[model samples]
Target chain A: MFGVTILGNNSAIPAYDRHPTAQVVTLNEQLFLLDCGEATQMQLSRYKVRRSRINYILISHLHGDHYFGLIGLITSMGLLGREHPLHIYAPAPLQGILQAQLDVAAIVLPFPLHFHALQQEGVLVAEDKFSIECFAVYHRIECWGFIIRENRKPRKINKEQALAYNIPGYFYERLKNGDDYEPRNGETVKNEWVTIPNTPGRSYAYCADTIFNPEVAAKIKGVTMAYHEATYLDNLIERAANRFHSTSKQAATIARLAGIKQLLIGHFSSKYEALEPFLTEAQSIFPNTQLALEGVSYRIL
Target chain B: MFGVTILGNNSAIPAYDRHPTAQVVTLNEQLFLLDCGEATQMQLSRYKVRRSRINYILISHLHGDHYFGLIGLITSMGLLGREHPLHIYAPAPLQGILQAQLDVAAIVLPFPLHFHALQQEGVLVAEDKFSIECFAVYHRIECWGFIIRENRKPRKINKEQALAYNIPGYFYERLKNGDDYEPRNGETVKNEWVTIPNTPGRSYAYCADTIFNPEVAAKIKGVTMAYHEATYLDNLIERAANRFHSTSKQAATIARLAGIKQLLIGHFSSKYEALEPFLTEAQSIFPNTQLALEGVSYRIL
Candidate 1:
């Protein structure tokens, strides 16, 4: 049920039938927007991604290719009569920018918009079932990478065993929490005997616009999958470094070092007309590497 | 040689395979961008419009649908190493918004970007071959409409007559300027004998994002073609008025009043799946009415 859908996969200049950097991270019924580039809202609708279900938006940096479509999405939400509060996590300056635009247009949102500035990278979101942690990355401007991990699920109760023990149905919630069943006879039934652990939770890491930095590999280690920017091929390593971007080989190497189960590479430069070379280059280094194609959803198993 | 290519035609919410308002006005070799909505750069590329030739961009209002794609287009120009200067005519607030984004991204353009704020309605560009003027429009915000007019062409020279008159090849320029040739013998070669007037110049008016306002009809009179925003159908006249938008019938009425030869109606509401009703409604009043389909060029005859 947890997956990442790619809305756009191109780099600074959107060309060759590809768009800029934007994606949707789906965790069950809730959707989290990742780096909304231009036309992201349209792409969401095109892919049948429910815009109303998206309550969280995470922006990696101030690059136009990364977040130019944010204001439009926000405005569209208001026009569509979204009543639920939306949360945006981005650089501090983004709040002022959004506020200025809204003020000039004299637009009052129908819902509340909460802005959470990413001044210092840490645990930005922590819930009972999942958590999101952000860490700094090497880029020309302020940027960060995020790791979303689903917490271990609670134990499942054995319904037949509970009924046989004469446990009341109203106490199922407590039983799922590893509580023993106690009847009026003053006899206590063991919790482990009537319950079993649920399946293990999965994790996904998003490495946004960044150069080749191997130091953060440990932070993303053992994740179900990792998405890293491969803006150029290995032949243009100098160009990639100058632009504060990453090469396919460099991204794949980091994914291999981090022991990720699947490696997704995208944010391709407009100079490249063919994306097959990027997949080839990355797979040469990490055999599990896959090209991040637009509109395709990569499940985190 | 003068035409407008539609990039997007939907209203506030881009859906149902349509996009927001965006168009490219082509005057021979030059292209002027009009109301750059989301993913305008992609549309320009899709239509094979020369991005390098687009030296001017006109933004009608502060609405996100009108200009949300501007920053991305400008940034892409810089990333593509555009050395020619780009001029943008928009509301005063847009310059600051673009500057803030560029500053935060730490991106310095390779070319000069000139911002001309549209505080009043006046002529923005006056060249020998063409001229562009902006006029106020009745919208929710401080919006403006653009009128692009190709200048009166020069006279076509009769090469045989000029050669027989012993008129120097260098004097051909003067001949086109409606000047008669004179030899040392004091015999004047009448201008009428050597040249004929070229075809009359054509004009196209863009009435961007506005409600029905009859006062400005005189300003656009005698235009070859006009593009008006038909945001809603006749049935939603109340809704259109509440949102400061216009219906197809209203747009047609204005086009007819302005004496326009051809009328293009667009900026359709996303609520409707079919656009045929818009054409039918508009054409009922103005027979020359046409639907502004994306990638279709409406030539000013």
Candidate 2:
């Protein structure tokens, strides 16, 4: 199953039992950690996320709220005897930070940590099952965003159609994947006659801390699911823009402009105790908007 | 008001709702944080600790469980615009680590942070009200422990005796501080006649991470309270020694040998779930032993 779980939704400061930004994106058997905040390790335990399965970590920036938990999580992974190679994609400076932290503590990780400094905004990882892409965002300092695209879905098999076509049972496997079957009798059976078209591949976009920029929308247009930062209410539009953050309405505007299927809004400011205003405001512009609550999983339909 | 609150009790990994080693020592109005582990900031919030009120942070070692949350807490303090100077006492390498992290993120702290490298085992801070001292411990790497000594307690003023002695209200304040009252035209009244002796100011010692060493007891003898790390049970004594940790019985032995009035034992290994066995084993050797439960305050009487 493919889904995204919110580990922490708060911004810079941890308040109201809400933590800083961190999320767990599970695609098949692999888990991708996007922006590990200070509480990421503990939150992973709270949400029962298998740490060993997290093969990739994508950090948007060097901001403390975005990647302070990287060293701790990596240390714990070492302590747990994880041998799998962990790949980290982040800003160029993170490699130095991680090295200094580990060197000072004399920690030798048991796994091979491949640090891929995100210098440009493009594909970071491309596997047979999925692909990951990064893009630049307008922020106070150097920052970036990420989007994950899953592999194409398999064609659905029609049992009645397959039997009616008199195709051999052994060829049904290929038929379900849109492959034409040719019997020894010199008769060709078209794939469309036995299988129906399944839905296309799904995509999830993570727009890390950024201002109200339509370019962000243009980069990740028509995504199946998108998580946008709504750091403030509509009333604080000026305050949000001045700090290089976005308000609920601005996030919703981007979602509406991008024409995405669903919008998940989070990165709430510590000043606000109630998140209902953000959801209600965002939903006015984007009807399929939902608050990114901690521990709640959002699956792209 | 002189008490120690446990923010985290677990040793290396966070388990069973327990975090790593972090404690809040409240001395009158001042709060001193000891060994900030991964969840220190969140645990501080969970227990309603005023983050701004903490003036001193003491880190014993460079272990991730001992000081992983240092940067996060400092960053949060900076974001909150704390102007008062914060003092951090840890090993020398931590300064480089902190500098690298702050430089990469371009975070200019609002407050002045004074980093005091712990080199020699001696007095780190000596004030009129309290004194903080550090000592070396037996760990895998270079580690140190801290002991806080409060100033002498004031004499309790005996109201009836003061009235009988004809001491004026203005002179009572001085009398409580063990000062003899000299009237304008009369003979001096002895301090003992007006005031009775109060209990002496208490002392609390923290033995961070160490093997079973009898010298630890000799260093902190007669302390009002002492907290020692007990990473395993008595059966795992060999394992504890190999890891440079202490078993429950060993921690209790040190407490008993030191003749401390009370003992608070923590730093439990993640392998154990139920803590009752630890309490039972420690109490068998030291009757005044208590499990260092998170969020609970243990006052030094």
Candidate 3:
């Protein structure tokens, strides 16, 4: 089950019940929070997202709309008696800011918190099945974008053939790894006789708050799913450029340039109450575009 | 129209749709925000409280549930192009915290901010119609409580008598101040003939997070309306004492001991879903007690 859940999708100001930017990426058994904005914890609760299951938090920037809800969420985690280790990947100054908040309240967390400063664009998390990488994006201040890719090669086992060969059910994982089964009767069952190659793993990219830059498109090329910020429509191209944001047309252009399968656009400006125009603009450029609505999950297929 | 609107009333963790502690005090033409918790800005929006009208903010403690929304609210104000000055009265360390947040984002607020540290906690604001004072409260950490008093003595003018005296409408303010009005016709209208003394001004006290202490009741005696934190019910008195929090019965006792006309009990524990027991426990001791429901305005009369 690989998908991205939209918790909040608004920009700097919250309007029309649209909250700031926050997204949860589910890759198999792991959950990674992309960006935590103000009231994100409330959104998480409203959507019935399990806060305890989240182990990784990646902050894209230091904007108040991006990381203001971080303190409340983390403190609530401690109050809920979370004992597992939590990891945070963000800019250098975030460490001091979090420390100051903890110092002021004199809070001693029950869980081990690992802070990874984002200096260079590289791998952030490397697990057995998936890996998350961070890359620089063009914003007014220092910012970053993240991509999570499933990096495993597994084979699909033929159940009929395995059962006919009298193979045990518990050896399916080894069969998927292309291992031959040796039964108690000393009969050798070849791996290729019952196994075939499976489909390749998928990936999802979170293009956190960036301008219209082809370099960003080049970095996340050929991703299965991509989320880009379309803060304004095409008519407000100058305004989007001046604010270091992207328009709907620009976001769709990047998605098309990167050859992504599915494109999700969000971070709508508070000035916009009707979002159909944003959809029209993006879909005109890229047909596989969808509006990132809160509480809705888009499958990474 | 002097009253308090409860924005949030939950304790450390938000549950059952109740948020953290934050209140908006409407004193005539001025608005004062008390203890901005996480998502307080969203609450202000939900309650239709004009964020632009809030000129003063008072933070009681350094708890994350108390002040996590400060940065988001102020930054949104800046983004909305607020030009009026905003005053923040909090602990000394808060100044550095705000500075660090602003430095990371490189945000230059459009309005000038005044930070008044609550060192001794005496007179926070002294205006013509009202005066707000801060006092120490017994909490786990250094906390403070606040009381707002209407200071001016106003006189009620007799409309019939003023019409007979041929007094213009502009002379009403002077008449309220016990000043005799002289018409252009050279007839002196004595203040005693047309005006009568009105009732004394009302007062509201906000006893922030604290334990059961008689000293706090002594500080806010004779207040018209008082809001005390009731973090637990009577059954959890030992837990309340351990956490330096007050139970429902204790909050009512403080109100009764202080001779308050009305009592509001809130800051409910997240463990409880139903809040009717809180009102029942408090009203059992003090009949005028009411539960502080979010978005409900409790008049200071």
Computed on C-alphas against the true complex, the DockQ of each candidate is 0.72, 0.59, 0.73
**Given candidate 2, what's the lDDT at residue B296?**
97
- Residue lDDT tens for model 2, A175-291: 766799888887798898889988889999999999999999999999999999999999999999999999999999999999899999999999999999999999899999999
Q: Rank the candidates by DockQ, best first.
A: 3, 1, 2
Query: What is the per-residue lDDT of model 3 for residues A95-130, given as tens digits with 9 covering 90 to 100?
Result: 999999999999999999999999999898898898
Which portions of model 3 show Cα errors greater than 4 Å?
A156-196, B155-197
In candidate 1, what are the lDDT values of residues B199-267, reduced to their tens digit? 878999999988898966877888899999999999999999998899999999999899889999999
Question: For residues A160-229, could you state the per-residue lDDT of candidate 1 as single tens digits?
Answer: 8887888888988988888888787877998987889898778889999898998768878888899999
- Residue B275 accuracy (lDDT) in model 3: 96
Task: Tell me what fraction of the real C-alpha contacts between chains A and B each candidate also makes.
Answer: 0.83, 0.71, 0.90
Q: Write the per-residue lDDT of candidate 3 for residues B113-210, one digit (tens) a residue.
A: 99999989588888889999999999988899999899857899999999888888998988998899877778788999999889888998999899
Ranking by lDDT: 3, 2, 1
Model 2 complex DockQ against the native: 0.59
**Cα lDDT, model 3, residue B10:** 97
lDDT of 1 at A70: 95
The better candidate by DockQ, 2 or 3, is: 3
Mark the regions of model 1 whose C-alpha exceeds 4 Å error after superposition: A156-172, A178-197, B155-198
Candidate 2 CAPRI classification by DockQ:
medium
Give per-residue CA lDDT, model 2, range B216-246, as digits (tens).
9998989899999999999999999999999
